[model samples]
Target: MSLETIDLSVTIGDKQILNNMTIKLERGEVLILMGPNGSGKTTLAFALLGHPKYQINKGKIILDNNDITDYPTYQRALMGLGLAFQNPVEIPGLRLSMLLNAIQMKKSGSSFDISSIDPKLIIWARNKTRELGLQPSFLEREVNVGFSGGEKKRSEMLQILTMDPKYIILDEPDSGLDVDGIKLIGETIDSLRSAGKGILIITHHAEITKFVSPDKVMIMSKGKIVDEGGIELIKKIEEYGYKDYEGVQ
Candidate 1:
């Protein structure tokens, strides 16, 4: 049972973005991919979710032994693949509450009043908003519209929780969080791991590594994985820097 990419190479326009990258995240484990800017961490996230802009030159995306290499983005999501964006986008004219209701409609074939969301979902959303240090009133705001960085991240989590995909890809989730926010994220991640969701966290910041002890850490350089190991690899990278792993096979 795994969500993985095998021998994947991707290119955008005439420029190659990823080169024969292979990554695997088993159920109930957390894998961290760390790299400096332009190392293709975000590109991997996009490719895994089947973003059309990234052309797959060759590779296979296997989700729970199912070949989803050619699956569309929404199809991949419906098949239990999920992502939390590093920079969440705002959708004008769309209330967060309304979006949750829409997701329920799409996923469960559930229907409800357009004016009122399911009461249970509202309660859950309210609790989640509070747990993420957001006021329940946020459920009423337009998605990511007028939200602070921390708030947008929390909003993304709320949606992810509602969807509850089995495999989660979080793109720099701790990028702009304070201590409390980071701790809350750590707790959320721990819960997800316990619930048996395979998670891949992409980040260059080591602060997030302090909160959760990952099963494996991968160092990506110039679109390829250069080094991979346990937590010790993180410490080494911290001391000697990513320069040590550059051009390393």
Candidate 2:
């Protein structure tokens, strides 16, 4: 089973952002997508997750063997797809604890009933917060509200851990993180990879590669994958930049 995009093309209004792009992510593997700015990396991530704004002008998104190109965002989540946004939104009044509980219920296919949840789940969440180096009290705060950049990344990890999705799409998870924060995020990603989850990481700066070894790397330009290779491709890009691949098809 795999998360596969076949000949995918996307547009926003009249302008095209992705053009005949295709990629595959299998379970128990990590695929890193790197590109210069405006290369449509984020657009591909959004299209995979069924973002309404990214109109799929062509191609299909396959989850396992199911064609999910037309699935709603919530449906995709239920099909074991998860995305950690680059800029997580702040919900002023919604507590993090509440959100986690909701996600747990959705994953379990159970009716929403906070009163029926086991006490152990609450304990488990608190333990996760501490393990991620977050304060136990942070779980009580509104989701991402007033969180620092590092805190926001950690918070997103908290959700991913709790949900335990089959495939995860992380958009620039290393951005805005300090050295220690990057280590923490990298460790979290390693743990998930060890658990046999498929991961797709999109980044402009390849800093996270130092911590987590990606199985394959793809470079994008003009919304298409220009080149793909093993980890060595990352090093090449780091040294020479995307100049040589600017208009490659």
Candidate 3:
């Protein structure tokens, strides 16, 4: 399975946030998007999930060869598309397990059973939480209600594992993480890659590439992908930063 964006562009009023951006992630491949702040990385992510604020002025978002640019967020979720937000909102009165059970039912189309839930999922989540230095109790709390930055990212990662979608788009998974937190996030991506999941990771930090060894790297600036290359580009960015590369004003 694959997700491809063809000549994608998004505009809000007179501001064009993304300009003819094209990107593709095949099954089991991880692609990293690197750019400075306001470079439209998040804009592209939100557009893929069909956010109402960012208007899809022109372009098509295709998942597994089916157009999904006009599909609602929930519909897209049901179609094997998952998004891990940069800043997840706090939903009061919602337990983490309850949310997971709902998503589990949606994906597997089976009756919710905490006892019969997939062992692999529970094991992975347990291991990930331990690896991230989080308490097991963290998983039982409300979603992002009072989570720290690191906790929130780990929570999002757990959901991704549970959903096990065909395509996963993560926006800035490394932003507020410390060394261990970042490592856990990288390990999670590596696990997903090994399982043949298509991943699109939006991040500015080059350290994340060390963990997942991205197949492709797309550099965005002013809402356009100005450069695309391999892991070597990640090294160059580490040495010289985005200013040394082309297309940034």
lDDT on C-alpha atoms for all candidate structures: 0.88, 0.90, 0.85
Name the lDDT of candidate 3: 0.85
RMSD (Å) per prediction = 1.3, 1.3, 2.6
Residue 27 of model 3 has an lDDT of 92
Worst 10 residues of 2 by lDDT: 113-122
Task: Flag clash pairs in model 3.
Answer: none
Better of 1 and 3 by TM-score: 1
Better of 1 and 3 by lDDT: 1
TM-score: model 1 vs. ground truth = 0.96
lDDT of 2: 0.90
- For candidate 3, the per-residue lDDT at 203 reads 87
What TM-score fits each model? 0.96, 0.96, 0.90
**Clash pairs (backbone) in predicted model 2:** none
Off by over 4 Å in 3: 110-128, 245-249
